[model samples]
Target: MLTSYTIAVIGGTGPQGKGLGYRFARHGHTVVLGSRSAEKAVPVAEEVAARLTGVDGAGAVSGAANAEAVAQADVVLLAVPWDGHDELVGSLDLAGKTVISCVNPLAFDKRGAHGAVVDAGEGSAAEHAQQLAPEATVVGAFHNVSAVHLWGEYDYLDEDVLVVGDVVEAKQVAQDLAVAVTSRRGIDAGKLRLARVLEPLTAVLISVNRKYKVNSGLRISGLEGIER
Candidate 1:
């Protein structure tokens, strides 16, 4: 299974994955929605295509396995779970491409994010992915974002993106992806090392969700608006 990577969403079968795939496709990126099964991926890609502004509502996209998608994409989005995270990174061919890691590393039974993968140096899932995918420029982003809200519009969720990556080009690609989806902007938060802090925020947000009983997000208020 291989989806071309002009821009591809790996694990696009999930809710968050589909939302981003849809948003990026809407922004005119020739998107591939990656899944374990190509047949399963087709419908999701078609659904995203149906929403694009200028694209024929009948637009079609490619789908394939994780590696094939990454191989072809200029940029790749990783929305896989924590368990699959390192495994995928270890197997990917990231010679010159920008990699986006969108994992939160939270363990849950029913309530949600009850625990985290404590083995990581900083216990950050995104940082772990950055370490595993050293060859690729790993950027940390979209961990706590609500895909349901991102897919449509939910007043509770604000869309500012925090881009963290060691490589400037990769970070910019991440920023572009973020800006394309949300009405808000992307802020480069230095290097990928910072994901140690950002990843845990997923757990923190979970605690907030438990306390407030709602999906919540962050918004840094004073920066002037910037274009993608």
Candidate 2:
């Protein structure tokens, strides 16, 4: 397993990105919160670092513009909204990096949330990312995990992260990192194609949360002592 990593959260000013950044930092991995501008991300990074004060095993936290953050990171997590997903991702030079996409393309309406139709026709954001940056190894994960619980006062979340990728080595890297949030290895949900299911599943979780007024997450069964 990799001992340490410099993780860059692309949409770090947002709740999901900030929450993930907090978790990674808490686990002793360097985290850089990235936004369109460094000015927007710096204060948020400061706020996250402030919250980790006196916390054991916390790593260094910083902020930068998206491109700068990606340039410095070993692993990059895309948590930006779907609207600008293409533009932002296409703009970055992500060659030879492990890119974890947690962005869910979904449209919210009066009825509820549902998967948005992707223009790339790749079925999910992860696949779209793969298309845009073919040189980078793209993995799909953290789609269904709760942003609230991640940044909340909880020590660790009780959930299973489903990681999908065409590359086995890259997938394992993401699985190992899952312990930072879920306190367990991420389940190898299958190839990058499966992201179609995992991405849209977030909408179902959101709907469930609204109905039950709880932060719902996934828990896989029958995998006891089974390593993926």
Candidate 3:
């Protein structure tokens, strides 16, 4: 059995953040949906809580300002837009928490969306997060999971999330959280430096999603240890 965690989602009003927050809350984790405006977040969090009326793990949702969310969470998931990544991290003091970086740096034009080439000065988003919050155990994950499926389509997620981080215990916490969200498995893709490769993969999945009109996800073939 996994220990229940107070999970804070930074951009919890947005589609991706909201979906992830909903799933976590429905599975017994305490979810704090955070937004720049507390007014906006509170309503959305209430709506999500209302939807879980008859669900098994209901009534565990709440909302707050971004700073308060981080202050109260055992694990923080950074789901903000790439443009806002630096500003958000700099303002928070994530001294000894487990931080998961789920931002995929990407851009779009007339043709389609593509991964933005970020210098990061350190490595990738997770690595950059490590620099900003030097005492936090930052992990890169949730890059390939579809927000649509998370919120609207499936009750049980059958996908693999590539979890990359230097800290072993933090990575295990991420993997456990992944499993708690309806059987989704978190695969240890490598160390935190590997995020440079994992982040760009989201762009390719988006391009395919545009073509097929499907909220497609990844499945690892040979991961025997990860339970379904």
Query: By lDDT, who's the top model here?
Result: 2
What ranges in model 1 sit over 4 Å off? 1-5, 53-60, 109-115, 153-157, 225-228
Per-residue lDDT of 41 in model 1: 83
Candidate 3 yields a Cα-based lDDT of: 0.86
lDDT of 2 by residue, 17-132 (tens): 99999999998999999999999999999999999999998999999999999999999999999898999999999999999999999989999999887755567899999999
TM-score (all chains, Cα) for each model: 0.83, 0.97, 0.94
- Cα distance off (Å), candidate 1, residue 169: 2.0
Winner on TM-score between 1 and 3 is: 3
Candidate 3, residues 41-114, lDDT tens digits: the string is: 99999988998889976538999999899888999999988887898888987989999998988888897887
Each model's lDDT comes to: 0.71, 0.93, 0.86
The best candidate in terms of TM-score:
2
Q: Runs in model 2 with CA error above 4 Å?
A: 119-122
Error of 2 at 222 (Å): 0.7
| TM-score, predicted candidate 2 vs. hidden true structure | 0.97
Of the two candidates 2 and 3, the one with more favorable lDDT, higher being better, is 2
